[model samples]
Target: MQRRQFVIALTGLFAAHRIAEAAVNPTDPIKIEKLVLSDAEWKKRLAPEAYQVLRHEGTERAGTSPLNAEKRKGYFACAGCDLPLFLSETKYESGTGWPSFYNFIPGRMETKTDFKLILPRTEYHCARCEGHQGHVFDDGPKPTGKRYCNNGVALKFVPA
Candidate 1:
């Protein structure tokens, strides 16, 4: 009984430590230093398509992203600043012809209302570089009913 009690106490301590770590949110843009760069610098650092998507808020054609077919274990990070945005496990086939995710890494993205399409949409960007990644919608599977439709050109996959 004492041993079980000790184990429970240790588990509680571990859980508390993890919760504290989560509270800090290392990727939170307000807390972490943001990466700012000039247009020329960004152009030089990224491909033409990546620049259009990440810097100019351009969307790639639907069904055109190779990342849509990606199935290996990896992280989809911002092509502009290499910030991990989505985990492989969170990825799903939303049939939106994009690399879709059910969730994103906490604090790695920020959202703003966009009206470019004549309708309001929740567009999200990378917290580190403020690069455009994609938009989030309410249509998604369980646990979190949010579909983050992302532009493939704006991301680079990193194997875990």
Candidate 2:
């Protein structure tokens, strides 16, 4: 093979390999198709915070989530699908900008690395509609050792 051709082929092979490694599980490609809502409809359906995060992919101010102190028996549903993602029992105080939960209802979220903060963060979005909720961090009380920090704007509290 010519030197230039060999280099091109090698580069293509490397690029393909990198792309494959960067992809998440095909079965869990952050399914957000189910959560799309009309702007006017969402305006009437959601509070300002919920609408921002669930629809517009906005983030709430850190330490501003009332859910941080929320300690009630209820279900936390997606602001988009009303799909239950976390139970009240798993909720905890992470003192983060969003609600923190130790556990999820299972298979209800998809996570991707976020670089908006100039640091790689595990940003999780609702699995049903791909709404950006918040980032997950490792600093939390243990059982799962995973803090599912969620934007209060992306969730709806349904009291049980």
Candidate 3:
């Protein structure tokens, strides 16, 4: 029947769309200017949680990061590379139980599509070290409708 054929075509189109969404590449291989360490070195350099989050692109549990409560003026840097990723002024209470930021230091991050959760997300990482920081979402405060949801273990706060 025409109805059955139409249904099949629609399903095929939906599948193609999902594939395209997941096809966004993470990062291209290039010579990095900043530090590049082997897996063993990273395991030794970072704490267990930091290594998991930064190196393996793992997310910490919600409401667990002390940075969620951080209110002082400071910079948030990558735990693996110490590259300044965000400023104190950009930090906001997103109520997502994580250290959410409205924006990041320009030129310090690179974004790629992540299909880990089945839905595609714009995941960003440290441009210098290629360490996974977190994903950026559209739901955020004014000026920039981007919420850079970061894992606390992936960053180190430096008080100014």
Candidate 4:
């Protein structure tokens, strides 16, 4: 093969590999559902932050979550559905205010592009009920190379 043609072929192969690695399933449509809570019941159930992020798609300030320093064997549940989504073993200190996990229990969460801050970010919600949780990122401890950074307000940690 000609040198120039060989380089072009190699470049195409590399690009294909990267694309395959990055491909993820499209999130299901956000389905609107009636709240399963009475007004007083929801108010009593969630904190202010939890209400905003889980019910209203709000983001919390970075580096402010106590979960960043949390070190315990447990499962993290969606504050919305109470569904288990992450293991404490996957958690990491991403210094991003929320709880950062390297991976999730597959198919437990979904994503959409968030333009709330004038920038595009991949925002994820609980797959069970489509409750807004938080964003995922490329910046994370390796192996999976995914930072499933979740809003501390959107999760409730349960000790094992």
The residue ranges of model 1 lying beyond 4 angstroms of the native Cα positions read 1-31
Candidates sorted by TM-score, descending order? 1, 3, 4, 2
Q: Model 2: runs farther than 4 Å from truth?
A: 1-33, 38-45
Q: Write the per-residue lDDT of candidate 3 for residues 2-114, one digit (tens) a residue.
A: 98567655655653453233223212233334455668878987999999999999999999999999989778878886667788889999999889999987777999999
Give residue 77's lDDT in candidate 4 (0 to 100): 71
**Which residue pairs clash within candidate 4?**
63-97
Q: Estimate each model's TM-score.
A: 0.80, 0.69, 0.79, 0.70
| Tens-digit lDDT track of model 4 for 33-81 | 2224334545566888887787778888988777778789877877765
Model 2 Cα shift for residue 45 (angstroms): 4.2
Candidate 1 lDDT, 11-55, residue by residue in tens: 556544543453354234334336666698789989999999999
What are the lDDT scores of the predictions, listed in order? 0.83, 0.71, 0.80, 0.72
Q: Which candidate number would show the highest lDDT if scored against the true structure?
A: 1
lDDT of 3: 0.80
TM accuracy, model 1: 0.80
